[model samples]
Target: MRKQILFLLALSLLCISFTFAQNNVQQRKIDSEFLNAVHYYENKDYDKALTGFDNVINNYPLNSKTTASYFFRIKILIGQKEFERAKDLTNYFIETYPSSRYIDEIRMLKVKLYVDDSEYFDALKEIAFLIDRTKSISYRIEAKTIGGQIAKSYLSSSDLLRLSNAFTGETVKPYLLLLLGKAFLKEGKKGDALNSFTRIIGSYPHSAEYFEAKSLIESPVSGEETSSGQALVGVLLPLKLNSAGEPTSNTAGEILDGIKYAVAKFNSGRTDKIGIVIRDTQNNEERIKQIRNEIGYNPNIKAIIGPIFSNEVRIAINDFDATGIPIISPTATDNDLTSESENFFQANPPLVIRGKIMAQYIFFVANKRLMAVLNSVDGYSPLLAATFVDEFSRLGGTIVTRQTYKSNSLSFAEQFANIAIADSVDGIYVPLAEKSDAPAILSQMVQDSMYVPLFGNQDWFFAKGFETSPELSNMLTFSSDFFIEFNSKDFQEFNNEFSNITGKDVNRNILYGYDTAKYLLTVMKNVDKNRTAIKTKMISGLTTRGYHNNISFDKHRMNRFLNIVRFKDGVFELIERFRSGSL
Candidate 1:
């Protein structure tokens, strides 16, 4: 009986060992499949990779590969743009594999996905969670980078409270300091911003932020080495002395009047001041070259303005390379010039800046849901349309349609009809240069039963035919830099002075010219006629209490304040004023 019992025990042991061996083989197979899935996923063949991972999960439910498989499957879902599904899978992975090494990476990816989908608040929540949960240095750096970007976006519109809240602790202190400086700069608080930047320079000397901080603070003010008395101001303009098919020279004449007025005012009380020199390019390339050659030899010419056409501006930039003379265009609205020339500045707001402001006004101020952009054939029109699209989309708004039309084309009924068929867009933005075209566009839209609100640039108010077109008058909203309706007495007094000097009514462009002169004079009073110093003053958001607006400059030297106007009963009225911080 003892021998029989020993044989049975031995057989049972052998059977148990065999079953264990089979289980090991199966687990190895699942592990191999899971690794293969990861390889395919890295190769971007997400469909097959997902299938393989699913097979691993189904075949080896309790194996070591299970957690890894869940993690990788979440990645594949994200790659496929299946965000909602990927979010659910990520939650599952976090719950089931709480000890997984990739938890922080998964959380970062979730933040990125939310950002990509325009779910900013949700992304902020994930960032908060990651900051609260993780001690990993890499993850903390990532959180700071993302948080800084979001804070900068809010700061663009002058939302400082949100920006301040974004950086809370010592871990993100450096980035917060830099961002606070930028925010203060946006709100026209130069002293504060400068202080913040100076702090970074002093405290974080070894960091990369210190390098950028130093570069910014040093570049703009360096040009002030030359004195105003020693420097010559170059004015490049198309004088339009003889041009066919042009209006009664009212616009150019008014511009020149404003320039002369500024110069006269500056020369009135000052002794040994900088002299203003004018160069008329006549909108010709050869003339521009001659003018550039003349200015190139004269060291007295420290700055320039005008060359109103976009092509002319390009020529001027190429001809004046490394001259260190800043060119401020009084009327040019082209966007490409600024990108090409660091020395270039636009006294009139660029189309892109105006477009961005218009988008913000419509989406945030007016609370409009859907926006449609109607673009003209003018070169600036496309840029305006594109900027509106980009800024609106960035702010979590949808663009209903982008319509393009040839200048002087009368029949827009078909285009209006098609736009009307699109889901009800609450606002429409038409950037047309010619007033004659405004009535036709508005008439077609109104005839098509499209009563949605319309928005446009200041040009709409100056358009000639808009006065008689009731439909256009009723549906129009526009933006301008200056308006006569400001309740401030200082503005009224300035308007009176401007009218007396120029003999023209006060408008946005006039205000721009006056402010431009005021700004130049202000710089002249404080700094020598050095282009660098003037640029620094311009970029530093120097405060100017002007007739049109409380003006300041951004990093790119674009004006930060815009007045929102609406046309009612045949006149443009200032409906609201928009500044950086006031939303």
Candidate 2:
């Protein structure tokens, strides 16, 4: 009996040893698979890594490697752009392993995933949770940074103010303060915004938001004008005044009428006091001379408007050499003007900027590839045409032919004939300033049996040639600044007011006159009559929203918005509006 009992005991012990060995082997396999999966993930072979991780989780559900496998799986999902699934997995990991060391990492990953998907509001919520829960300083810093961005994105001035009042603490307060400043600036509260920017500069000098804060403090709006109690206004217009063949009979008279109208409004009755002055140039040569004289002699003229021609603007560059006086142009389309002159400002749409809008409409909206440019010798036309060519080329458009026409020439049949023969070309870009050029070109194109899409400049609206030419029916597209329809209420109101005031039909030129005047008058209200103050205010980035549209000068003092119009059935239809700043 004793021998049999001992044998049973030894057999039981062997069975227990076998069971322990099996568990040890299974655990070793799970650890090996988990390590290999991590190696694959590190090598960026996510598909293979995911396969290994899936095998470990599926076969060893209760193994010690499960937590790590879950974490890595979330990362792989994120790499695949499966943000929604990654978010769910992150949540699951946090809930299942609340005390896991990777919990902070999971929270951060969730926030990032939300940001990647542009779910800013949800990101904000996750950041708030992380800020409250995480103990890591680096993690908290990240959360604050993201929170600042989210607040800036969704919160307006009032909303920011409310948020600031609600959130308080060392970690959260600074970001909220920065957001508050941005909010105030967006609401046009200059004083409050300046104060907020100043606070950030003084206190958070080492913070990442410091640079932006410094920029706001150093902005033109926050400079000497704000402190000196002087309003800096800008009047931008092409002052060259003279055009080809017109000589003494130039656009200067129309520009002057606009200036006088603005001056009259300023000198009349208004709360804002302002000063106005004129800078005249015969063309490019006279423009440079006048600008130098104004900067050297006239310290009183705070703002200058004129130099209506593009070539003349190159001459006036000396005025922008840190004179601090802003030059606003009513009409100048050269794209390089803004980039060249820091103090230069414009009130009209630039051709380069407008060309982008035209390209977008033609290529993306119209879905056409082949194009032709019917270019003119006028200063603005060539620049605009070149811009269209460069932009369209970058967008994969094939230019079949670039046809050139002299501004004063009457013959264009050969140009149109070339385009008509190229049956592959899909569209035509015709930029002309003179009214007579378009109809003749279009007529020739029609006579040649060219039925391709046509695009034109703002001048098409006033072109009498179009009114008289049967080829007007061939105009498929064009761009303009303002239009007066027979039945529109805005047009009727503008016509009545303009006729009563100027005793003339409101033509395109007259609309320019009114808008220019309104812009100057609005700026003048905040300025002193002294020329220096006027010039200072005029160039100080003051924007004017007028009857025609909103007017703001770029760095070179050029207008930023132009309406793209189309001609159909003998009447003009509004197609799109291009703003220089937005593009």
Candidate 3:
């Protein structure tokens, strides 16, 4: 009996030794496979990397290497923009590795997938889930930014009101005030806009959005009432210019819609039928010339609003300037546009001013000395980048590095990797216009555990992926000419009225149109019914405050006042105001 029991014990020990050896072999194989997969990923051969990662996941047990393999697969899938597959794999990872340290990362990727797919509502849900169920403060703050963005971009008046009511502390108070200020400005309630902006600036100076609030206070709104007058306001809008019979991408239909509303309001308030002669330029240069000729026939057309595109205005500026008809472009933002014609009044600030203001914010307000820049190769990025570098140096700040990337590149790994962000570096400036780029650079930074505050221009806020990625969303600080408090009583009123008029929500172009038209009506009504008189009035410090902006033409005829905003604890908090000629 003793011999038989000893034999059983010996057999059990042998079995346990064999199992432990087999497990060790499997782990070694997974480790080798994972390292090879990482090598493939490094070389940009996603297919082989994916295959190797898949092999590790399928052949190995739940260990660190296997856990890493799952995340690597997710990253590769996301890199491919195969978001649905990536999403499925992310879910599988969450379910399979519930206790993995990489879970927060996986959840963040899931949110990015949703944002990339334009599923903002779904992304919001995922963010809410992370905040509620997870202990990660970084993830929670990221959720706040996502919520603020959704509120900024898509929330209705009632929805914004509800959100405003729900989150009303210093943490979200600036955002709520901004939303309300925008809403008020949209509704033409300058007083309410002023109040909301004032509240943000006075109550929450340390809030990230305080800069924008201060700029809002400085937004020049001429409280001048419309006087009765007989003037022909020429409205040149590219209402439709596409080959498919749809409006072209560059058309100012929203601004045109706002002009219509302003015209209606003007006619209702006064006895004079201030004639609005509407012309569609098809956004074509030749058509713009034709429209100019048409305007020449109507000598009574004293003031013109629009010719929205800078290129379009370039085509017609000569004709209007030759005839002395002052053309106020509500959205033509080329820095040199005003230089082309003294008669041209730009409603939006030029990109050069935007760049200068951003540099000032970084150097003075944020108190950072050294910074790195990742600028896109095309669009307004290069120009903005040049302007910032020049201005930052002029302001006694140093650009540690400036890297450029093709706008169409799928990844900024090469860019971020090359940047040596030493302890002396204060912030990173990414002048990328697309939201896609924001996530690529930001995700790489997050994965590498590189925590640095980010600075940008307006494009960062409007980027598609910005609403989802918590790390990128939380670190952003930017500046722009437009900042609407979307939940203000004035905005609610404007939204209702505008929707009632056009059966649609108000857009930035629409607000530009409304403010421009209203300014034209107000200024023209009080001045002589002539182009010279209108130009003199506008150029001589004629200012009118809107929801969150001041619609004014400087002596150089460029728009004045831009809002500097920073993202912190989840909302783009106002930091300060950047006005023209102020370093």
Which candidate comes out best when scored by TM-score?
3
- Candidate that beats the other on lDDT, 1 or 2, i.e. the better one: 1
In model 2, the runs with Cα more than 4 Å from the true position are 1-253, 263-269, 278-301, 310-315, 332-336, 350-354, 364-367, 373-383, 396-425, 432-449, 458-475, 481-487, 498-510, 520-550, 553-557, 580-583
lDDT of 2 by residue, 1-583 (tens): 9999999999999999999999999999998999999999999999999999989878775678887788899989998998888888898888888877788788888888878887766676667667756778668766775676676667567766665566555445446666778678667788888787787677766654565566556552322333243333434344444456232533566656555555555667754455544444545563454345334223333555656666766556544444555565666656677676665666676666667657766777678799988888776888778878887787888888998888867788888877777768877888885777766776676567676677877777677555444454545677665654557687788667656776865555545666776776666664455544554666556766554556655334556556667777777776555554334
**Two-way TM-score contest, 1 vs 3, winner:** 3
What's the TM-score of each model vs. the native? 0.51, 0.46, 0.54
Q: Stretches of candidate 1 above 4 Å error?
A: 1-225, 228-232, 238-254, 267-272, 280-301, 375-382, 402-424, 433-437, 444-449, 462-472, 480-513, 543-552, 560-563, 576-583
Residue pairs clashing, model 1: 157-580, 223-532, 228-529, 232-300
lDDT of 3 at 201: 76
Lowest-sum lDDT 10-residue window in model 1: 219-228
Q: What lDDT does candidate 3 reach at residue 48?
A: 100
- The sequence of per-residue lDDT tens digits that candidate 3 reaches over residues 1-583 is 9999999999999999999999888778878888999999999999999999988877656677877888888999889988889999998888877778888788889988988887765665565556545667566556655665665576544544555555545655566666667666655778877877788878888765565566456542222222233578888877785576555543376677788888898889677678898888777775665565455424467788888888888877864565578888888888788878888888888887788878877887789989998898888899889999999999899999899988767676677776754446678888876666766676667666667788888887766555456765677888877777676788889899889877998877778888888888887776677676788888777767675567776577877767877776666666655565553
For this target, which candidate reaches the highest lDDT against the unseen true structure? 3
Q: Deviation in angstroms for 455 in model 2?
A: 1.4
Give candidate 3's TM-score. 0.54
How would the candidate models be sorted by lDDT, starting from the highest? 3, 1, 2
